[model samples]
Target: MTSPPRRLPGEGTAHTVEQSAGELARLAMARMDETLGWYRELSAAQRSQVGLVAQAGISQFVEWLRQRERHAPSAISIFANAPQELTRAVSLRHTLDLVRTVVDVVEARATSLAGPGDEQLVLESVLRFSREIAFAAAEVYAGAAEARGAWDARLEALVVDAVLRGEADDSMQSRAAALGWDDVAGVTFVVGRAPLAASSPDAPAATVDSLRRAARHLGVEALAIVQRDRLIAIVGGTRDPLPVVEHVADRFGPGPVVVGPTVPHLFAAGRSARAALSGLTAAVAWPGAPRVVESDELLPERALAGDLPARRRLLDRAHRPLTESAQSSQSPLLETATAYFEHGGSLEASARALFVHPNTVRYRLARITDVTGYDLTRPRDAWAVRVAVTLGRLGGTGATPGPAVGLSDAGQPAPVGRRGLEESSNL
Candidate 1:
């Protein structure tokens, strides 16, 4: 083509460099546009996060352009007249720089999400990341009117999550402060239980979700936390522990349920709940049906209740040895002796109580000394024998221990017994 006008080799190299630079500039502009689009999709917290990075990137890009202006080629004037193109180039360069910084922030936040030690900090970090993501997405969706609706929805979600976390934290702090953790408080109740294995098809998700839904149904607002195959909930604003315990048991099934005592406030509630759980564990292990247990209910009988079968556990632990000893059993002597001894060593009373002859009651009282070498005449051992026998009769088999399965206020058997015992106790 006319010898190509005899162009120099250096001219070809310069032209190639200009073309490469223009392509880089175009790519930078595209990135800026994409970033702006992403920004609109971000939440308030996310916008704040990206805003810092955006400022730094913009500053660097401006300084770079100013430096380049001193040596800019004459042909670059063409872009000068194209303000839109120039603006896009500047925006893109800034966004690219910010993206690098944002990546680092996101990674750090994700890492900390697993085990953020301070509860408050954990909440704050969630808010911070939410903000970052919202802002980044907004940058990506910037100036795209047709797709703006979709980005707006996403941004709304991000903002909601950020705000919700902050509210939850503030609410927690306020509740804590009021409970006198700000001053002082007693044991904390940490109410929780390990979730049982899913019972049926669709039960796992269905059970948990149903419980959450039911809280609303019951007009109860509380936090539901799932941890280690367990659902833990903290409830505030109620002094009546019984109703809540009943309500939860009714909802969650009867598997070893426990309700901790209401402490002075929320701060101490965690400890109280843990203690209550321990009692529930012991009760479930004790025997009988799945029962809702309480900490205070078990304290009286815990001492000797350790390994006895359910029927015998409460009686045996609450008193001294009541049942027949092995040697005394050979002669029916210990049982007879205990009965007579429990009758205040009164032959007539012991006979009437046992539906036996007074002679037989006296004869057994004599054998008590022979079999175990315990003189029923001694006041202390006689008292022990009396209490033990009473407990045995109270907790005897072929009978129910009444509905008083839990601890009494004084760490004693619940004052209310059944039948004659119940009637007499009531009197």
Candidate 2:
């Protein structure tokens, strides 16, 4: 009885908007194609998503008018019907432009689409709805950005793991390409103990993010991750990478932060990774080493700790080149170096032992540096020369007791002790 008594007049503006929804959506799309350059460039599927969004906007405005008295509609729900690819294919700015286009179409047709007394009301409602929808679009984009960031982080970790494991095959390379690391050249690898994060569970990721932000200022590309207690980073520097590494060294944990040599490209970065890993393990031997020392500087410790690559590097750079310099004497510089180190790096003692004058010993020391790049006066350089020369002798003697492998300080034959004998046999 009450329902039949006095039925209020239909909401004219809401009815008109509902009737014109299909046409208004078409007009909005047409206007977008006419005005927005980026919109025209979109693929067919993306364009279809844009159409769905425009149609939804008109329908939502009608619903808002009808249901607003009891429950205000969430303008955000206007985008609920849109596909996920809509957000990815269309940027926030582009989406806002589309929304503005829909609003413009509706406003331009307000006079014709509304009942006589409802035109101004429809126009005002459109203004308010657009403002709310703009905010809703921004919130949607914020969520997309958050999701994209997490996915990119996981992808970066995969690329780094692949590179470190020397699995730089096509599959890994494709993944790197997805991360925009395909064309990068001259990548440097850095290794150190991951910082303790007792105060925060997310310290490692935060530290890595901070490091990457710092590196970006230098125009460097950085990919870093923390694996348990080990922090590994692969840095791509266009200029001298050492300066960038030096600038970022304070970010690492309290331990040796070893930087490896640069390789030609990311595909070849495993070589650098190996060296950095070996240097990090061997760094404990040199308590006085710099916190950000190059892996090459730790060659002596690495070679001594059974890193075959380091041993081969020392032999090739110093022993082989020095021996090659003397075709007749088989590395006379070798004997000069042997005497210098055996006498506690004393030039006079080395001269007395080699039966040469002090000046001749001094001249030979300069030649040693020229041939081997290791200065005998520097303790680290002396350590490297000792290891290289010892490896050279042991490598050459092969199951035979030789004086070269165990030379006394007096430049005479010394006994190959039980330890030396056992060590030499393995070589």
Candidate 3:
């Protein structure tokens, strides 16, 4: 300088304070750059799935260490969800690997710091690194938990939308595919709506989670979604569906629960969901019956088997009693006919269901054609009879006619025509 520098009041005391603050700031900046550099190096070497998350974990770890030293409880809460997030983005496997890497680095640094002169610096750096690791883990855990919550929400929305519209979204199909659900031949959704008691130890929502765990334990891959108002789940890719259905029913309590039929693919999950919806609807419409409403089970054989003419004929037979004869109550006749044909012409059971004697059932059978003009006991009339019964039930018609003769030795009577009449055992 051309001249001596002028000093202000308290210049001597303030100089020392300014110098110390500046030094600490520089050190903090340097440490941050170093931490970031380490993450970049690791990312480059491993080609990790989420480099950004990894870097964020590193930065967050440093911040966590600082906050913890300052005793910041609020800051810890802010990062409580971070661990799950990190796990979701980078995967649990990678997180563990990164943790291992941090451990190894710390160990190597400790070994190098054995000399007397470097002890304090080594100790400080080790503590900082350890704190960072802990925070990163916390964040990753938080992230994973968050992802699960989001998945639950999305799944519910997709299911409800598909059910209401009678179709599935492409995004849901893709998400299922991403989760390795390739063998998704069909889909079925189950919901538990009854409000669990507040005091109950095992609530409905808790039961849903338990069932999900049970499915996983049994190696049945599935998704359990908990919504604000309901519990929903989708089960698929198995050779058998009944066992799973029964399992869910058992969980929700043998009370009012609904199950849909097996549909084509992941896209058909909604169809099943809607079926569950229908099952609930039907259960409400007709109380104290089976809560299950399979599309094929409730609809006529032809409708399920896709035989339109047979359905028309069965419907014609079922309704003929109601319209053709003012004296005849077509409702009971249709119910009996449906049960008889559905049971493949088992009179005893059909009679029992209709609360009529077996012979009364037999007389009713002989009268199907009299009312509908379609022979109930004929081989050619079987499909038509079945279809009519299904349409009748759905359209408020009655059952198909009973078999003319008794069932064969195998229990199934021969088809409508050319029957060497199997022995007609008294019902």
Candidate 4:
């Protein structure tokens, strides 16, 4: 059998603390108003809720000292009587500040609230109770944080999906706003294969969170979600997203990571998302591409992969320019460039086939570079130039072009024996 609990000498002190609980709560509020800038800024309704919490704390302390509670006082009940909104209005730090202020008020009045020989007990109890309250506050906030994190994760996925699917309506905008994504400027989309380690359904969120943190460290705003095998990240708050993508490129799985062109804001992010995803699909064609290749950089591959927009861009920027160059000038750059590719990139060979001086071939090559920005001498540029020329000749539907002057059935310029005069045009 348990021994009867011995009576403590603090009964008189407990009775005094209980009787003065209302006045003590008022004193704590006055002290908070003087010391806590945040407290004074609370709206009237919030302040009223806070007052109830303080009153509960003081009455609970009296019971704790009376041995009515054999265990640590439950702060859960203190918050129970208060409005749920109070938890958010008052952060854990502010709650702790309130606790400290109340503790200070109680300690200052230990002399009056305690019986003659019970002053020491009252002071020690305040110190112990304050420690308990601190622990309780941490526990409460930790629980709140977990619940918030889960909710935010679901909301994040919805916002990301909506953007990817081009459904960013007012409802989606409001949902994105809930996740703090409103007003993000210079938004861009990045797509890459999810890391192998995050292949598990439960593991992807943790990986995305790491990416989000890395982006935020650079002052970029980011939202992330993993769809199927792909990890999509929408980052903003920076005009140049190149560095931001490079910074987090290593966090993706081993494959080409594609960053789309930046848009003005979140609402325009679907354009970026489509391009980046298309680029990621086409990236496998170029094994030597950089770890973080921009969507614009993969236009040729994407065109070859049947992406209409990329095909249109190649037609406008690459293929059409070469054909147009022939109209304004007598030299046939398209025929010369094709022969240059057929003869193993030999500039002199292409010159012999065209019967122009090597210097003329060199000049036309320079003009080609100017017309389309593709340097035929470089391997990558050579490949892109050839692809564009082929697409233009075979696919150029409405253009002012055909096999000019010198010809073979194969559409290449037929070689002429060295002519007395060299090819020259000033246009």
Residues 66-131, model 2: lDDT tens digits: 653423356566777787768878999998998899889989998887787777877877877788
Which 10 successive residues of model 4 have the least lDDT summed?
A: 418-427
Tell me the spans in candidate 3 whose CA falls farther than 4 Å from its real position: 1-86, 114-132, 169-183, 198-208, 223-232, 284-427
lDDT of each: 0.42, 0.77, 0.49, 0.79
Residue 391 error for model 4, in Å?
2.2
Candidate 2 ranges with C-alpha deviation above 4 Å = 1-10, 69-77, 80-82, 116-120, 237-239, 328-331, 355-359, 398-427
Tell me which of candidates 1 and 2 scores higher on lDDT: 2
Q: Which regions in candidate 4 have their CA more than 4 angstroms from the true location?
A: 1-9, 68-70, 329-336, 397-427
For model 4 the TM-score comes to 0.86
The number of residue pairs in model 3 that clash at the backbone is 33
Best-to-worst ranking by TM-score: 4, 2, 3, 1
Write down the TM-score of every candidate: 0.31, 0.81, 0.50, 0.86
The true-versus-predicted C-alpha distance at residue 224 of model 4, in Å, is 1.2
- Better candidate by TM-score, 1 or 3: 3
Deviation of model 3 at 1, angstroms:
52
Error of 2 at 123 (Å): 3.2
Query: Backbone collision count in every prediction?
Result: 39, 0, 33, 0
RMSD score of candidate 3 (Å): 16.6
